[model samples]
Target: MNALFKALSHPVRRSIIDMLRKGPMASGDIAAAFDMSWPTITGHLNALKEAGLVSPERDGASIRYRLEISAVEEALAFLLQMTGAGRKDPGDEP
Candidate 1:
């Protein structure tokens, strides 16, 4: 999941993911939310797509990006496993 982590390393990509959490959004709409140029926003979207965090759907002439929750879950599962979550410890006081 190096690609997933790498894509998430950027603040812009994180913001894009956050925006997509609401629902699928057009590329133009996503780009409008950022101060950077369209090309820069596109690069971030490409990273997210490469990481499987987002999927692009063709909506007529525009492309809408939707979040892939399963991929996100995969990442969360990894983090939870590394953190030892949901594991009962018998060495604790009752």
Candidate 2:
């Protein structure tokens, strides 16, 4: 999807997704891993959320973000299709 690609276009956002792969983490914890300000990291998180790549849930006073694996799978499948990978050619023999 357009939104997914747009969100993934930024290195910061990509890194955020990588971090989330481990497990859900508090926003503060995620911000601490980077050198940028908390507000800046928040912007990247917002993009990921808008693209459906991440979901934020309230955890008491803090919010934890979790990766949406289905969205990642959707992107992977699209890439595979575009590259003719994991897809059979119609002319191939059975």
Top TM-score model: 2
TM-score of each: 0.92, 0.94
Candidate 1 lDDT over residue span 1-94, tens digit each: 9999999999999999999999999999999998999999999999999999999999999999999999999999999989999666999766
CA lDDT, every model vs. true structure: 0.96, 0.96
* Residues 9-38 of candidate 2: C-alpha lDDT, one tens digit per residue: 999999999999999999999999999988
Best by lDDT: 1
Q: Least lDDT summed over 10 consecutive residues: which range in candidate 1?
A: 85-94
Clashes of each: 0, 0
Positional deviation of residue 71's Cα in model 2 after best superposition, in angstroms:
0.6
